[model samples]
Every structure is written in C-alpha cells, then in structure tokens.
Target chain A: METNVTNIIIEKVKKSRISEVDFSNLPFGKVHSDHMLVCDYRDGAWQTPRITPYQGITLDPSAKIFHYGQSVFEGMKAYKDENGKVWLFRPDENQKRLNISSKRISIPELPREIFMDGLKTLVQIEKDWVPTTPGSSLYIRPFVFASGTGLHASPADQYKFFIVCAPSGPYFAGKVRVLIEEKYSRAANGGVGYAKAGGNYAGQFYPTQLAIQKGYQQVIWTDDNTHEYIEEAGAMNIFVRINDTLLTSPVSDRILDGVTRKSVIDIARAEGITVEIRKVRVEELVSASKNGSLKEMFGAGTAAVISPISGFGYRGSDYDLPEMKDSYASLLKKKITDIQYNKADDPFGWRFEVI
Target chain B: METNVTNIIIEKVKKSRISEVDFSNLPFGKVHSDHMLVCDYRDGAWQTPRITPYQGITLDPSAKIFHYGQSVFEGMKAYKDENGKVWLFRPDENQKRLNISSKRISIPELPREIFMDGLKTLVQIEKDWVPTTPGSSLYIRPFVFASGTGLHASPADQYKFFIVCAPSGPYFAGKVRVLIEEKYSRAANGGVGYAKAGGNYAGQFYPTQLAIQKGYQQVIWTDDNTHEYIEEAGAMNIFVRINDTLLTSPVSDRILDGVTRKSVIDIARAEGITVEIRKVRVEELVSASKNGSLKEMFGAGTAAVISPISGFGYRGSDYDLPEMKDSYASLLKKKITDIQYNKADDPFGWRFEVI
Candidate 1:
C-alpha cells in the first residue's frame, strides 16, 4: 500500500530522551522514541492521523479494551545501516496482518494508507532512536484498542489507533530453552489464534510462567485437540531442520502467518535447501531428535529474526541440540540482517528505505 | 472469605453526581458510581487499599494489558432492598472466581480480604448511586491488570487491581434470540475458557457482532473441536429445559463456572425439579425443539439473572421455543431476586448485607 508521508502532522518532543538513553544497556520495549502517531476512529471514520510527542493518555476505566480486550497489534523494526540510511523491513506485511487481526477482534480495519503513512512518519521522526548497535533497532509497535466508555459484550463504537516506537536490543539474550506444552494450549482449532490479538497472548501467560519456573525461557505450543502436533514456539513460529531438510508448520486458522517464517521458507527454497511446510507431529520431532536427524530447532519472528533453540524439555525429559559449525539459524540471521543493514543485495526486495 | 472492612482507607467524593442521575432511565455500564477502590500489587505483595473518586487512571502506553491482554475481571451487583439496605449476592463466589481467573491469566491472585473489603466499602459508599427502580442495581466490576511499562511476552512484574461500580439497569432488554456458532469458537478445550479473563471476552466480540448483524442478540458458542455441543450463550452459562429435566452444560476448562448457573440448578432442585448437569449436544437441542419436549431455554449470569432465549438459529435454519406461563426462567428469576432483595428467606445464606 502506497503511503503519503507528507500528510502526517508533526509535534516534536519538547525535551529529547536520546541524550539519556544508554544504547549499550537497552531493554526490549522499555524506552520510547521522541514521537508517536495517533489516529482516532469515531462516527464510522478515521480522523486525520497526527504524530505527537510520546506521552501517557488517559482512558476511562470502563473502556471495552480494559474489560473485554478488543485490541490488536503488530511488531516490526526500523534499521539504520552503516551508511546512516534508515530502512524498514517488510512493514507492508505488518500493515496487512494488523487489518486481519482487526477483523478477527471486531475492530475496524485501518486503511493501509493511514497505517503506512503514520508508520513512515513516526519512524522518520525518531530515526535517531534507531540504534546503530548490532542486533538493535527501533521496535515499532502499531496497535489499535477500544477507547469507548462502556461495558457491553459487543464491539466498541470508538477506537484509538497509535504507532509507538521503542529503541530495543535483541529480544532474547542468547540461545533459549523451550518446553513442549502438553496441557495448556495457546489457540484453538476455530479460535482467534491466527490473529495477532491481545487475548491470544494474555491466555498463554500462565502456562508460559509455569514453563519459566521449569527453567525454560519459552514454550513450544502444540495443537489443542491432542497436543500431538507442533504449532508454535512462544510468540514466534517454529522451524525444525532435520538433516538437509528445513521443516516448519504450515500456517492455518490456528497458526499465525508470520512474516519472518515466510521469509525463511522462501530464503531456504531459493538457497536450494529442502523446505517442507506441513503439519509436524510431536512424535516425528522426538524420534528425529533421538535418531540425531534433528539438526536444529529455531524460532522466527520480527523481534529476534532468528532465535536459535539450544534444547527443549518435554514430559520430564530434556533434549539438547549439539553445536554445529554451519547452522541454518546463523545463516538466515546473517542473510536477513545483511539485507536490513544494506550490506548484501536485496534479492527479495524486502527492505524499504525510509530516508 | 472473611473481610476486614475497617482497614480500608476511605476518601469520599467531594461532589456527588447523585442529583444528576436519572434512576428510571439507567443504561448498562455507562454511568459510574462516585467512589472507587484501588490496590496496587508491587514487589510481590498488595499495597494498602485506597478509596477515591471515580476517575481515569494513567497508564504507560507500553503496559502489558494494552499489548498482551494480561487482565481479568468479575461482574456482580449490589441490590438495594425496599428497606434501603444494600446486599451482595454470594460475593464469596465472585471473590473465588476472580482469583481463579487471576491464576489462569498469570496475574497474581488477589487476597480474599482485599476483594471483599474493597467491594463492600465501594458499594457502601456508592449506595446513593444504587437505583431504587426494579431490575436495577449498582454493577460492581472488579478487575486486575498488568500495569508495568514493557513489551515482554512474560508476566508483568507490577499490577493494579481496582473495584469500580456503575449504576446499570437490566443487561438484556427483552427475550433474546441467539445464533448457534459454527465457525468461530470463544474458548477451546484445555484453554482459558473457564476463566473470566479479558481475552476470553475480547475474542468473542467479532463473532458476536456478526450474530448481531444477523438479527440475533447473542450467539450460543459451540465447542471449538466440533460445533456439535452447546457451550454458552453470550457471556452467560446456558440451560435448556426439556420436559421436566433442566439440562445444562457441565463446567469444564472451556466453560465458565457461573454463579447464577449454579444458583439456578440449586434452586430448581430445591423446588423439586430435576436438574441434569452434563454435556449438552446441539443436535439434542434441535431435536428437542422439533419434538414437544423443548419447554424453555435461558442464560444465567450475574448481570442478567435469567435471560430467556426466544429462539435460536443454526445451520441456516431458525428454531423458535414456544412461550409458556410460569416458565423456568421466570420462576428462577423471581426466586433469585426474592433472595437478593431480601424479600424471602435466604435458605442458602447467599446474601451479604453491606448496610
């Protein structure tokens, strides 16, 4: 979707936080950039989008989002290459997914023009916050929430859409450990699992907390019906590299159509590596691990780009993957970052230059 | 749970909106009471509860509730009897359910004293806001949400719990028509369907809106695995009276254990009516409607004590239930209200008098 960035109303920050930020000690989603974009939806139409100073906004305690959770969000990143050029990776994908999530959550679908225009303007304004440090970028969070003051079970009449950016480092510190969830399920067969919705993440916290107590940083969620098939690894889509073949679970109504996951599949196929997208069974993974065919297991999402899994625990047993000299995770992470930082050729034309 | 009301720090509203309220024309959840209770959870313990004027509380834009839906809430009411005494119906049940929801959503469990003391103090102080009109009460909403500023998938370190009251009339206006959902599911087996979490309600808004467009007031949500069994009607637990036996869906991980549903079952049994608590199939309900055995159908919840179902739409066909004098819904509504308003003997000792 083509966006007219000139339409954004700018309200620069009175006092910049850039001087205070410690780029070497950045935390994920804690520090905000100088400006944010706000758009209000009321009377069946979206108001003019405005880029304002990043600050707190008051909401009624009875807002539907507070009670019923009618909120949808998207996560993307803005990068600064070595040449000081600002770029956004696959932001159009995030805009499309946000509308899909809005439909699932009964929120009004944001126009592509507004989403793109707001995002580009906000990122351009906060370009300095785009850390030059490796693995760090401006983590852009564009979210829409119900803002009306009522407690009915239906959709809210008013919505507030905003694009907020935070300067962040890596999502995960290092190689992560995951637990295979057998009891608690993230999304159901006919539920809003595929949607990047607020409730979907909220429901996973308890089970995820339990996994954290068990010494795992994340959970590899299985199907709700039998817990026999793999679905996702925490918030990211999972991929299993068995020998020379790269296998990931196919996107379904219950699985998010991740941008990074799709990119990896395309990149692996382009690189002549075998890519299989199908329903992956838990038994198959365990057997492959036992037989030493499970070369590596990694998670793919916008936050980390490629989160290499060290090991996974399931049903009181742990399986560890041995270190490899040439791993797919490292290769793909390099390839993606190369295009993002403009070091390598953009074969897929995935990078969008902001300035 | 025993509550120590004397420990609450009360700050009365300086200027009450009592004179501006129109008791006879009350709308659900729009008008709030004068006072509200606030309790913060930080450093692993609940802070001292404080009562203040009903107003908006500022939250960081990066609060987990905005992005991850880490929130849970309970809905209840405080009825004013003809003698001007306020009474809470089985508040212990609400207190227990809130903590249960908290556990499911990874929000820290609220202490029994805090839940009870907050509710009692808020309702007592807002007694003037409780309408005298029949079918009207002070709607009490107790909610807990992740208040910390961050965008992690894990649970929040800081939380906020609030008890807010609104003057609301009946939740449902007249006899309601419902549609049997075939595609979208609210909750799944082994999911957080049993908890009154924000996500559970948020996920239903889209589907519920579709049902509304189809001229139905609510949707009778079916099981996620198969749309073969009837699970719930809107936000309430469902019951179908076939001949003499009152059949309702058994509480599972996918179905909320509603206070009014349980009360109806107990009241029906006490009145010598057979009550069957088991799995209720959709086919059985349609067949019962075809035959003469389908006596009545109703939804039970705190907001609407007993909402009678006029008809239901399923599989491109609509089935209507015949109106009957002395229907089970009416009988139970009167029975429950009688106990709630202190007009009859409290056989179950469910009433908790606040004044």
Candidate 2:
C-alpha cells in the first residue's frame, strides 16, 4: 500500500501498551488492540491523525451523538489464513459506504488512505485476535460521531473518528426463522434507516423484542409508507429464490446498501442465477408461496454471511419453506466463505491482501 | 423533592488537560467540560460510577451502536436563575422519558434514583460553569447507550448511562420559515420516531440539509404512509392556530410526546382557549391558510420555548402567515419562561429547585 495520499496528512503514532492479547477463545468486541487511529478537524481542516493508545476520550454531555444521534459505523472483518497472510474483502466498498453514511448523518468525510492505514496497523498489532476457529474472525468497527458540545437540535461542529477490533465467532450458524412485520418499519424514505447510524437500530429494538417475545427470532421490516413491500430482515438484506430466479429489494434511501448483499448479488450473477434487484412485495411473495412457486429465502450480512430462512410467520399464519437439498443460500455462502478463507480462486479480485 | 432518593455513590474524579482547546467564542460542541459521568452495567447490576476527565472510552470496534445504531438520549436544561438558584425545569419528565427511550432502544433502564441523584451531583460539581447571563443556562444531558461488547445484530448486555451538562442559550429563539414536507417522512408507524433516539435525528440531517439548501430553515415532517397529515417540525412539536382554536397532532407511536407541547396545551386550556389534540392534515392547514382561518403556527420544545413559523412552503406553493398582534405562542412562551425562571406563579407546579 502507498505510504500516503497526495493531499491527505497522516498522523504520527504513539505506541501504546504492546502487551500481547491472546486470540484463543476471544469474545466478540471485548478485547481491543493497541494503537487506535484518530483524526481531528478544526477551522475546517482535518488535522494530522495519530495512532495512540486505546484510552477513554472526554466528551461533553451535550455532544451531538449523545443528544441528536449523529453517529454512523461500519462492521468489517480481517482474516489471516494459514499462510500468515491478511485479507480484506471489499475494503473500498466499506470506505465508500462510510462516506455515504457520514454524509447521511452529517459527519465529515474520512480519507480512504487513512481508513486503510489504520486498519492495517490495528490488525498487525492485534493479529493474534483473528481466531483459527471455523466461522470465527476479527470483527472491525470503523465509526464516526458528532462529538460537538451543544444541546441544540442541529448538526455538530466537531466529530471523532475511530476504529476498534473484536474477536468474534459465528452469530447464528443454523437456520433463521423470521416474522414479517406488517406494522413497524425500520426506516422511511426520508429517514436514516439505510445509513449505518445508531438511531435506526435503536428504533428496531422494542419491536424486535416484542417479536422475540412472541417466539420469532427476528422481525422482517416492511416499507414505511405501506407495509406491503418487504424491505429487510433484522439487520441483513434478504434474497428469495423462485424457481432458480433470485429476487431482492432494490436498495433505496430507506434500506441499507449492504456490502455482503452486493457481494452476494455479484456472486449469484456470476453463477447465472438471474438476480432481480427490485421491489418484492409481501403480497406477491405470499401468493407465490401458496402457489408453490417460491423456493427459498435467505439473509446476507457480514456476521452471518448467509442464513437460510426456514420459515416466515406472516401476521398469524406461518408459511413453512422447504429446505432445498441444494439451496442457493448455502451454495453462495460457501462460495463467499471459501473466497474469504483463501480456499477458492480469487477470480473477481474481490479479496485484497495485506502482506 | 425527597431526601431518601440518595442511593448516591460517590466516585473518584480524574482530570485531563486539553491545552490545545481553542475556546475563543468557539462554536458549540467544540469545547467540553472537565469531567464526565460514566456508569457501566453488567451481570444485572450497575458498576461503581466514575467521573473521569473527558476522554474516549475504549470499545470494541464491533460495538452494536456502531453497526446497528442502538442508542438513545434526552435533552434538558439546568438553569442558574437570578440569585444563583440552580433550578431544573421538569426533570422528572426527562428522567421518565429517558427510561422510556432506554426501554425502546433495548438499553438497560437507569434507575430513577440514579438519574436524579446523578444529575444533582454532576450539576453541583460543575455549578461554577453554569452561565448566569440572560438566556444562558447549563444544558443538562442525561443519556443511555447500547455499548455492549459484541456485534451479533442483537441487543447489548452491557450499557453506559451518563449525564453531562453544557452551558448554553436558546437554539432557535427568533422566528424562521419552515416547509411542510408531504413527500418525505421522519418516522413510520411502529417505529422509534416518537423517542428521542439517535437514528431518528441522523436520517433527518440529510433531508433537513436539503431543506436548508432550499432556503427553508426547518422541515415539518408529515406521516410516512400518507403525507396528508402534518406531524411535527424537525426538532419541535408544531401547533397550528385555526381561528381561536389551537390544534396539534396527537401523540401516537409515531410522534414524540414533547414535554413543552404538553405544557402549552395545559396553558391554553387554563386560559379557556379550546385546544384540540388530533391529526392536522396538510390539506386542511393549507386550506385554512388560504381562507385566513390559519391565524398562526409555532413550534414548542425545551431548547426553543416557542418558535413561531412566519411562513411555510408546502408542495409547490408558499404561504406567509399574518403575524398575530397578541399571539398565543408569545403569551405561552412568556408564561413558561416566567415559571422556569421563578418569575411568575407556577400554576402547573413544573419547576423543581435543587439547592
């Protein structure tokens, strides 16, 4: 990787406690590595960043994120194969998405090079945290927040950008059963649902808990204006297969544009699955299921990779989906995992390796 | 109000020097107070509270707030009225709302006693920072966050509850023009829009910025499913005057139950002015504006007691409201301020003196 971008100023590093942290059975998001990256903007100029010790930073109580919720974050993972090589799947897409989320939440832009450098150093320092366990990885969180100090219901004047890593295992290795929510929506046309902002998830907690209390594991949110169209399930983008045709909702301002969702779409397209990215209404899907046209449904995200939807509880009716012996979700998930674990050919150049 | 409420745990305070702070009329949020209150929850109990020099708390990069945005907060003001009487305007409402916000966001409930005792202690310690100038007050922020140590797209087990205060003044005291957005919605049915969650505000930053670019100062968000109903201004509850009757949208699951809005309703009723709490549609409002039935429209909130809307741009048309010679908003704002500053009779028993 290049040492610097032409216009950006990289900060100096202040090596923190070099004490080693074991990756063996590391719990997700509990242990952070040394040398976190930070950049400050004042007088409209992003100052030189510094890699400092992982310590608590002071913030005013009225900081915008604490009040207005002007915060957005991204979840990514870094993998170290048996050959001691580090691989980042679709890092560029993440940086771009972070920018989009920043703009949506009124946060300043983070330079792409800074994002990369920070990730590389953090992984190198906490390299042992990447577990060798199957279905386990190092979860990386890159977030930007409004650290401005005021009680006004407005955009913040200052911010804090950070990246932290956590060792994580499989979220849900087995199948997922979801409930279609015909009332609540995760986001609206003019809402922050699509962005990785903290508010969207906060909004879904109560309803999701209600769904969980009612025996369903997750709630699949529908369109805000009309609960007719299926948007997303929990925090992941969903895909349905109807007689070998892959269908998923088109990414709108209201729905998150997931990195895994895009990757799955590309892989499915390469496999000639005839993927359709458009509105897939609940009525149409429910009718197709009754008519025996709907084959299978699954969710895609960085955590789960891919999770087969075994069944869906619509209102009061539960529609049982057949477990395909040759499911597309399993196939795509395996292919993506293979590529991620460096077990498959990197034909599309999707994986970027850090030496 | 009660002496037995002191389940207070005295904690050590740490100081950090931010010598590089440029505080020359620095913009809001650019500077912070010396210390911040932090309390962590795990194992069904809150840990010993601590007040540390404001600094960043190390967190797993994959914390749920970063990815899912599961966070919520509250806004309340601490006033140093004349004679140095530190008063809180309806703190119980803020504490109750904070609990409700935490419940909806899936963050653990901060005990009522902790909220009250914490605020009193924090403000007392920082009492010298309380600005005494006219219109200046210490903005107290009591917030709870989902700072769990995992990233499974689920609710967090651990949380951090804090109360930070900022010395500030009115946000939007003067009148400004606003637009009625019939097409874009802020919250949806069965969503966390009513709560002062972070995600709700994050989504509005983009659309509100767009409105600002169009020369409008604020956006009055309507119902998502149908834009026919007028809901609220971007950060305040809206009140529309049709003749002598004041009408506002009822607090539904989709609308924030603003404390100021409720107070205004109570004052109007006390004055024998008929008040109605129901859905105010955009068409009806526009029609009323056309026939001179719309006498005035104003927004109510803690930050801005009553922000009169001089004009509203709706759809493809603009309507300038005629200024009221003796407006209800002006009268209510004056009465509320008088009570808050201990200048007039607090008929509603709203203010609570703290030492």
Candidate 3:
C-alpha cells in the first residue's frame, strides 16, 4: 500500500510483536518496533524509500562500512501525550545534523524531504509502539552507512539509510558520578566530533570503561591537546551551574552541537537565569566545587533529557556536589519533558506533532 | 572437511571463480578470492573457526558496528614464490596488532593460534588467487567488527573475525603530491591512532578528499594540538630524507606503529644509512626543502611499500623535491619486497611459509 506521504512504499509485518514487549519495564535500545524505514542511494541519487518489517540486512563481507567505518547516526525520541498523540522534539535539527555528518565523512548528504517523510510515515505506522509510561518513549535511531562492496579506502558508491525505533525508558536511572579525563581524548580539532559519526562513540567506550572501573559512570572528556578544558561528557553535552549562573562549553568543530544542549540554554535564559556558553576550564570547575559555588552538574542529550551528575573525580581526587531542592537540572528537565510530551506550550516551537 | 591446523572446518566452493578474474588488470581491493576465514566470539569465548565460500554476511539492523564503529582491520599480502610456495610476511605481527587494537576498543581478542591457523589455512586453500604479476600479490584484509544485535553505545557482546583476500596491484601508481595539513587532524593525543581502528581511516576521508580537490593525492597529517609536528600520511607512515639521513616520527598514541614503517627503518639502517626515529617538525622540513637539503620523501605501509612523494603543498606554497639517481625509497622498497616474495635471502626471517 502506498501512503500519502512522499510516495513511500509500505509493507506491513504479518504480525505485530507489541504483546511481547513489557511497556512498564523497557530497556534502552533493546526492543525495536515492528516496522522500519529504508532507503538506498545508488547511481548518484537516493532511490525510493520503503517501510518494511524490521529485519536483518545482508551485505558482502567486504562492505566499506565494516572496514572503514563510513557510518553516521542520529538519536531522537517520540513521546506519547496523555491524549495518545505523538510529538517529536526538534527533529529538523537531527535531520540537518545527519546530513552534516554524512558530508564530513564523504557520504552524500541525505535530502531533507526523504528523511522527514520516511521518518514520520514510519512513526505513524508504528504508533502503537510508542510507550505511554512516564519518562518512557520510542527512541528513534536514524542512521546511514556505506553499503558499497569494496575495500578501497575512499568514498563509497552505494549507501543505505535506515530509521529504527525502539521503545525505551530513561537512559540514566539515577544521578551519575563522572570522572574528568586527564589522559584520553574524545575528539580532535578538525575531526568528526561535531557530527554524529560512529567513530566518535567507539573511541569513548574504552575510556568510559576505565572510568567505570574507577567507580564512575562516565568520563567528562577534555580537549585533545591540553586535557585542561572541560569539553563534554560521554554521549551528551555537559552543563555546570556555579551558584546561580549556568556554564557550558561553546560548540566547536571538536564538540557536538546538541539539540538538548541548545534547548536547555534557551529555556534557562527564558526563565531569567544566566547561561554562559564559553570554554569551561577544569581548574575553574574544581575551584568552584571547593568554594561551594558549584551548585549542580548535568548531561543533556536525546536519550537522557537531563542526566544530573552527582559528583566528579579528577587527578586522583573526588569532588561531590551538594544537593538542592531547587536544582537547575530538575527545573530544565521538567520544562523540556513537558514540551516533549505536549504538556506545556512550546514557546520555542520545538515540538512537531505526528498524529 | 577439517584441517589439521587448530581444528578449523573447511568448506570449499563448488566452483572456483579464478577463471573469471583478470588478475593482470586487477584493481586495488575490488576482486576477491574464492574462500574466507570466519570466527565468532560469543558465550565468553571464541568458537571454532571456519573456512567458507566468499559471500555476504547477514546482520541485524541494530548491529553495534553500524552504530558505534567497533571495528578494526589489518592489511597484509600473500605472495607466491617462483617455486609455487605461498608466503606471508610477518603474519604474527598482524595477529598481535589486531589484538592490541581490539583491547583498546574493548572487543574480545582473538587467540593467536586461531588467527595464525585460520590465516594460513585460508591462504593455502586459495593459493591460486595469489597473483604472479611483477608488482602484484593477493591483498589480505583481516578485520573484526561488532556483530551483536543492539544499538547501545558500548562494546558488543558478540563479535565476528574474518579474513578476506583480494588479488590486487599496488595502492598508488606513480609519484604523488601531498598537502601539509594545518587545520585538520587524523587523531588526538590519547586516541586510537595507534590502532588500525575503522574510525581512524573514516576520519581521514574528508581531509584527504579536500586535499584531492586541491590537486594533492593525500594529506600529510599534523599533530592535533599545534599542527606543527608531522604525523603520518593518509594511511601510511611518512618518511623524509634530508641529504643521506632518513627521518620519521616515533610511534606514539597518535601515530600508528606501522609494520612497513619499522621494516623501512631497519632496512635503511642495515644498509649503513643514518636513520633518526624522532619527531619531524613541519617547519624543519620546510626549511630543509628551502635550503635544498631535502632529497626525497616517501610513505611506507602494507598496501604501498614505498610511495615516493614528488612535491608537497604547505600553506598556499608548493615545494618540489629534487630528483635523485640513487633514491632511498627505491632501495628500501626493493630490499623489503625481495624479503617478502622470497626472492632474496631471509636474513630477517620475515616470511612465513604457508605451503
């Protein structure tokens, strides 16, 4: 059956697996929806998009993605309001960033129309998969990879774009303790850090594992050169609240321009709070923590709207943050989640209704 | 059938495709041989290895490799000597480095016995695929990637190790020009630059493409911090020759410990040429070029034994090196290739006989 949206071909699954999923207890990225959106790029153009059953893909062993890591992905979520309507939070930003990432890795930029049409159509078809539980939503993963079958170390001639949705709960359960990285780095000056490239995440796993071994949940990466400036936490943009003012590192070629990060800054400023986006120094954060000025720390991303960080370790020492009833993290998270779930008016026009 | 080496199960193809290949006109990595080696890591250990017909692999859409870039690879060559004997040049080095790369990325390491046995058995099975052309041989690509079916940003619970061979010619044909990069970087200070990680190569495609647009074949990467010190070239270790002395950067966390790079240094030093293994500054190179002290420059790697650089572009200025009668690149390449193909005495014991 053909849908009214952008001529996307639809092939529904014979049976839906919705009954097998336990909506009350959802793990992140484990339970995928019944249907997926797939599009192919060949002969210098993106071919027709299709919505098919979520299944395995076959590719030659010499496919470029397996060898060269020519892959890029975007993370998004669909929240079901109490009215059974679904809303997406600034999905246009993810679409734009996906193309930006593709261009950086030498993959052809995906047209915005294809991304949006395919995504919305797939979500509308699998609306039942969206969880209605508080703080649980359908985590959408839109990714593109080189499917060209060759080992030549250049750009590929064939590609595949896919959008898979998984019903997932919050990314972080409780407040996390992070370690300030002093040795390892996540990105370089003119690297793919700004883009949602696959390599950027792989490089962080080892360092994060080391931090986990040291009893921390994640590592707050530093600048590759000096390891002096606070960059971002694992898979999320970091924010520090000193007394009443908020501080975050300005987005650079070495840092991701997170949608959640921007929303937090905008929402905080709108609430009459000071939001300073600049190069955050490690020494400043440590001194602020000691002087009782560091009020709160949190990580912002698609999966976790605002993951409050309890404390941080740096240079063989641990620093704990004081608890507060009126924390900025809680305030910002409440605001963002309200907008995402369509419970509050989106003054920034960030929510997109799918139903 | 089962092979005697490590209990590897062997499955031959019903029909060999050797007759269809025009090996004399082979591209770098487009054509493959008849069989490949496969080993899986699951249930806390590596399972029995297998040799099967070269074919595509089936994987779930949410495989970690497609999302997080948990992949590593090694490049090698299998040469058939005049006496119809197959030989691998330093197979143990490739096996050891593969594990080092896996450990850094938190992937399970393949046992040394499995790697060696699988590689030799596969090569022996497809010995006819090893080209006999003067400058051509079978290009072996041994790679591992995360195959577990999940999209979580962590090390995969399952992995697949494969060895695929492509009968191909050299990577670079003629002398080429390179751009001395000042803005872009290939790796960070404490990153996976030393590993043959897939991300390292993917990060280079854009900068290399930009250099290609500027009429350069490759980009001579610099340190991420200052962009002052010379790192490696696109996928090969770089060497600069000043007068009769050879200079190359020492392997660090941000530079690959290339096998061919080490071989070149050892061969040059044994030939009574002064070799300096230290940091090569960009300004020092430009000064040497200006003073007419620079004799030659070349890149060393498994694919391209020695790729001579004709000239270099740095900061909008192009500098050409003087042509020489007795170039060091030609001398070292000949010495190394001779040892690899068993044309000369095995003084270094670099060759491993497969048959």
Best by DockQ: 3
Across A1-355, the per-residue lDDT of candidate 2 in tens digits comes to 5654523333434653434555455555666665566776555656666666666656545556666777778889888787877787888888889988888787888877778776776676667657778777877888888776665667787877887666777767577789999877788776666778777777777788888888888888888767888999888898988888999999987889998999999999988789999899888778878988889998888877897888888869888888688889888988898889888997788887765
* RMSD in Å for model 3: 1.9
Off by over 4 Å in 3: A1-5, B1-5
Tens digits of per-residue lDDT, candidate 1, A1-355, equal: 3648437677887889899999998999888888889999999998899998888978888888888888899999999999899999888899999999999988999988899988887787888899999889889999999987786666889999999998999998789999999999999777899999998998888888889988999999999989998999999999999998999999988899999999998888888889999888988878889999989999999998999999999889899987988899999889888888888899999999998
Every model's TM-score? 0.98, 0.89, 0.98
**lDDT tens digits, residues B1-355, model 3?**
1245588999999999999999779999999999999999999899999999999899999999999999999999999889989899988889999999988888899988899888988999989999998889899999999998776788889999999999998888999999999998999888889999998888899999999999999999999888889999889999999988999999999899899999898889889999999999999889999999999999999998999999999999999998888899999999999999999997788888888
Candidate 2 versus truth, CA RMSD in Å, comes to 3.9
Ranking by lDDT, best first?
Answer: 3, 1, 2
Best by lDDT: 3
Predict model 2's lDDT versus the native. Answer: 0.77
Give one digit per residue, the lDDT tens place, for model 3 in A259-351: 999999999999999999999999999999999999999999988899999999999999999988989999999999999999999999999
What's the distance in Å from true for residue A183, model 2? 3.4
